[model samples]
Target: MRSMTRRNRLMAAIKYLVCAIMILVIAVPLYISVMGGLKSVGQLRAEPVSLPNPVNWNQYTDMLTGKNGSFWPKLVNSVVIGLGTVGVILIIGTFAGYALARIKFKLNGLIYAYFQLGLLFPLAVAILPLYLQLRSFHLLDSAIGVILPQAAFGLAMMLMLLRGFIKAIPLELEEAAAIDGYSRFGFLFRIVVPLSTPILATVSVLTLVSSWNNFFTPLLVFNSEKKYTLPMGVMNFMGEHAADWNLILAYLTLAMIPAVIIYVLCQKYIVAGLTGGAIKG
Candidate 1:
């Protein structure tokens, strides 16, 4: 018994050690990025890992308020695109997920499988064709251009997440809703929606973050620099300020703020939704 206890202690120590290392691996780079952004170019070069001798806020301030300001526009573009993408995913994905979950059909499995197959193909594979198609429809350089394709790519995964969660909802709830004079659509909107809050938050956060950080789609879709999203804005900022590592780091740090805040706020739902879908599905 003593030997078994010793073995368990050793395993626990190893697990803790591994977790600490993983945290450092993720946290160290982030620390450096934030710290490095607060230094002068010379200070950053001389002491890359250390805290700023005097915290500098110029780069961030300029990005926010200068006449040469481009960051705010990019930030707005990202927000609009992210929200639009999430709205599309939740609306379409919810309806589709509900149908797949509750409505019986011969091709139900096949249709769901078709959407799953979309997971196998990343956007890079279809960029050329997607570019041409977007051009044909005159979607280039528009918010709708970025939002539509981003939303499409996101739908499959959202459906995957939402379908499982909706399926786990008790049928008796629907029966109760029906008996109350609620139609099918009414039951879905009124009952299923409120009950599915966890999964909805999960989907919104996932879609929002993915859309917020998307570089390739925006890079290809927007020709006008004015319409560039944060990721593209970062790249352009880097090119214009190649020698200014501090400024670049500042831009990166600022860009990371929104997504980080969002994820932290919605993290609990992410865990609950994923677990609920997994256990119930």
Candidate 2:
């Protein structure tokens, strides 16, 4: 009994140590970025970890006030792209997921396996071909250019998550709705939708975050500075203010705020959604 108790204590200590390490790993950089942004360029370099001597707020204000900056435009672009990607994913993914999970068909598994293959090939592998296709479609420098590809790539994962959750939904509900004069589409939109909210929220949050952080895809698709997304705005800071570490850090902190806010607000839903998808379906 003493040996078992000792082993449990050791394991608990190890777990706590790992958790503390992970928190530091994430929190330290965030701390540096926030503090660094409030310091002057020289102060940032000289006293990297020290609090700001005079607390320079110009870097952030300059970004927000658009003092020769494109922060607002870049932020708006990210919002548009993120929302659009999520919308497309949810719309198409729901139908596709429902069909795959609920319908009986011979080619269903084969079609699903084809989508599963997408998981093996990351987007970078098809960049050149994707560029060519976008150019041919005259979608270059357009939000749709970024939105469509992101949605398409995201569809696979969305389908996977949604399929399990949708399958877990009781079929008897559909029969009851059918007797009440609910059409198939009506039943899906009305009944299934409410029940599947958790998984859908999960897919939305994931796709939105992915679309917001996608730098390369937007870079490849958009050539115009006006159409540039937030990630691109980060690169601009690195280039234009290369020597000004404080300015760059300010930009990083500001750019990260929205996504951070989103994650914080929806984190509970994310956990619930993922759990529901995994265990129920």
Candidate 3:
């Protein structure tokens, strides 16, 4: 009994130590970015790790207030692209998920497998083909260019998550609705969708973060500075503000806030969605 107790205590200590290490790994970078942004360029150079003596708010406020038409426009572009990608993925993924999970049909397994194949491949491999397709369609340098490819790449994961979640729904509920004369669409919208809120939130948060932080795709697609998304804009900003570490950190910090806010708010749903979606469809 004493040996077992000692072993459990050792295991618990190890787990706590691991958790603390992970927290430090994540928190240290965020602390540097925030505090670095609050310092002046000279102060950042001199006392890189020390807290700001006289906090400099201008780096953030100046950009937000349109001092140079840099940060806000890029933020807006990110919002538009992120929302557009989410909209397309949700509309298409939900129906596809429902059909794959609930409706019995020929080639359903094949079709589902086709989407699953997408998960096996990374988008980088197909960038050349995707870029050519976009160019052919005259979609280059447009939000549509970014949105379509992002949605296509993201669809597979979203569908899988939603399908697993939908399959977990009680079939008796669908039959009960059918007995009440509910149409398929009605049952889906009223019943399945409402019940799949956690998964939906999961997909939304994931899509938003992916779209918001997307750099390579936007860099390849958007040729014009005016249409540059936040990630692209931040890169360009970094180039211009290369000498000013504080300003660069400020841009990076602001660019990260929205996605961070979203994840923080939907963290509970993320956990639930991931766990629930792990069940086989």
Candidate 4:
């Protein structure tokens, strides 16, 4: 028993050390980006790793106020595209998930399998065909171009998550609602939706982050600089401000803020939704 206790303590210490290393790996780059943004060009160039002695606040403000290259416009574009993708995913994924979870049909398994195949593939594999398809449709360079493909790629995961969570809902609750004169659509909208809040929040947060950070699709689709999203904006900013490391850092820092805020706010739901979905599925 004493030997076992000693082994457990040693394992615990190893786990803690691994966790601390991982945190440092992630946090150090973020710390540099944020603190470097607050320094002047001379200070940042002189001491790249050091903290800002007296933080300069103007760079962030200037970037926000459009002194930088189309910063606000790019930010707004990202917001619109991200929200649009989320809306589309939720609408499509929820209905599909509901059907797969509740309704018994001949092709149900086949349909689920088709979507599940998407999980085995990444978007990079389809970018060429996707780009060609968008070009053929004249959707290239439009927000719809970005939105449609993103929604398509995100749909499978969202459906799986929703389906898993929906399956966990007791069948009796749905039956009880049905006996109470609730129509299928009504029951879905009123009962299933409310009960699936954590998963919905999870999907929303994930979709928002993925859409916002998406660079490859946008890079391929958007021709004009004005239609660029935040990630694209950062690239353009880097090019334009190549000499000014401080301003570049500031832009990068500002670009990261919204996603961080969103994740922080919805992190609890993210954890609950992921765990719940896994267990239920």
Candidate 5:
């Protein structure tokens, strides 16, 4: 009995240690970024690790007020693209997911396999071809250009997640609805979607984060200053002659806030959605 008790205690201690290490790993960088953002360029250079000797709000002030550049417009552009991409993903992915989950068709498995294959194709591999296609359509510097590719890349994952969730929902519900005279579209929008809110929220949050943090796609497609996304615009803070580390960190700090807010707000749904479909389907 004593041995078993000792072993359990030791395991608990180890778990606590692991948790503490994980927290430190995550928190340290975030702390550094926030504190670094509050420091001036000189303070950052002089005392890299120390707390700002005199807190400098200029980094944030300059960015927000557009003294350095039009940070607000860049932020607005990011919001537009990110939200637009999520809207497209949700509308299209929900229906596609419902079909994959419930509707039977020839070679449906093969079609799904192709969608899954997209996950394997790294973004780098398709960048060149995607650039050519976008240029041909005159979409190279447009928000629509960014939105379409982001939605396309996200659809596979969204469909995969939502399909599993939708499948987990009992088919009897749909049958009952059908007997009550609910049309196909009606059943989907009215019944399936309501039940799948958890997963929908999850997918929405994930899509928002992915679209917001998209640097490479925006970099390749959007060259105009007016159309710059947050991630791409952060690069502009770095000058060729000298990079402003404090300002760059401030931009990064600001960039991360919206994603964090969305995640925290919807994390409960994300968890429920992920687990609700695992084996129930």
Candidate 6:
């Protein structure tokens, strides 16, 4: 019994050690970045790992309202694109997920398999064709160009996630609503949608993050400075004289703020949405 107790204690100690190490690994770089952002170029180079002695604030201010155009507009662009992408994904994903989960149709499984197959195609492989297609429609360098492709790419995964969650919901609810003279659309809107808020929030958060962070798509589609998204705007910080490492880190941190806020605000829904179906099944 004493030996068993000792073994358990040993395991507990190891677990704590492992957790501490993991935290340190994740936190150290973030700390460095934050500290670096707070330092001058010279100070940063001299003491890259050290905490800011006096805590400089110029980096953030300069980055926010620098001569190369204010970051506010770029920030707004990111928000708009992110929100637009989420809206499109939600509308399409909800309906498709519901169909896949409940409706009987020919080759449903095969159709869904095709969607799964889409996930295998890397974005790089399709860039040239996508650009050509968008160009034909005069959508190249346009916001809609970025939005449509993102929505299309995101649909498959969103459908799979929401479909799994929807499957866990009992079909009797739909039948009951139908008997009450609710049209199919009404039943879907009033019943399934209201109940699926958790998953919807999860997908919304995911879609927003993905769209906001997307760089390559925006780089390819948007040529005008005014329409550039946050990631692309950050790229402009790069230069010869002084790489503006301070400003770069500051902008990077700022770029991440929205995603972090969103995740924190909707975390409970995300967790519940992701896990609810798993446990129920």
Backbone atom clashes (below 3 Å) for every candidate: 0, 0, 0, 0, 0, 0
What are the per-residue Cα lDDT tens digits for candidate 4 across 181-210?
999999999999999987898888888888
Off by over 4 Å in 5: 1-18, 269-281
Go through the candidates in order and give each one's C-alpha lDDT. 0.88, 0.89, 0.89, 0.90, 0.84, 0.82
Model 4 residue 132 CA deviation in Å: 1.2
- Model 1 lDDT at residue 171: 99
Cα lDDT of model 6 by residue, 234-261, tens digit = 7765542247787778777777777788
On TM-score, the stronger of 3 and 6 is: 3
lDDT of 1: 0.88
Instruction: Indicate which candidate wins on lDDT.
Output: 4
Per-residue alpha-carbon lDDT of candidate 3 for residues 141-244, written as tens digits (9 for 90 to 100): 99999999999999888988888779999999999999999999999999999998878988898888889888878988999999999988888988887788
TM values, all candidates: 0.88, 0.90, 0.89, 0.88, 0.87, 0.87
The whole-model C-alpha lDDT of candidate 2 against the native structure comes to 0.89
Give the per-residue lDDT of model 1 (tens digit) for 21-99: 9999999999988988889999998999999999998877887795444888899899999999989888888999999
Candidate 5: clashing pairs of residues = none
Judge candidate 6 at residue 204 and give its lDDT: 85
Position 15, candidate 6: lDDT: 100
**Range of the 10 consecutive residues with the lowest summed lDDT in candidate 6:** 272-281
Those runs of model 4 whose alpha carbons end farther than 4 Å from true positions after fitting are 1-23, 53-55, 273-281
> lDDT of candidate 4 vs native?
0.90
Q: Give me the runs in candidate 1 sitting further than 4 Å from their true place.
A: 1-18, 67-69, 271-281
**Candidate 5 per-residue lDDT over residues 114-221, each given as its tens digit:** 888777888889999999999999999999999999999887778778888788899899999999999999999999999988788888877777788899899999
Best candidate according to TM-score: 2
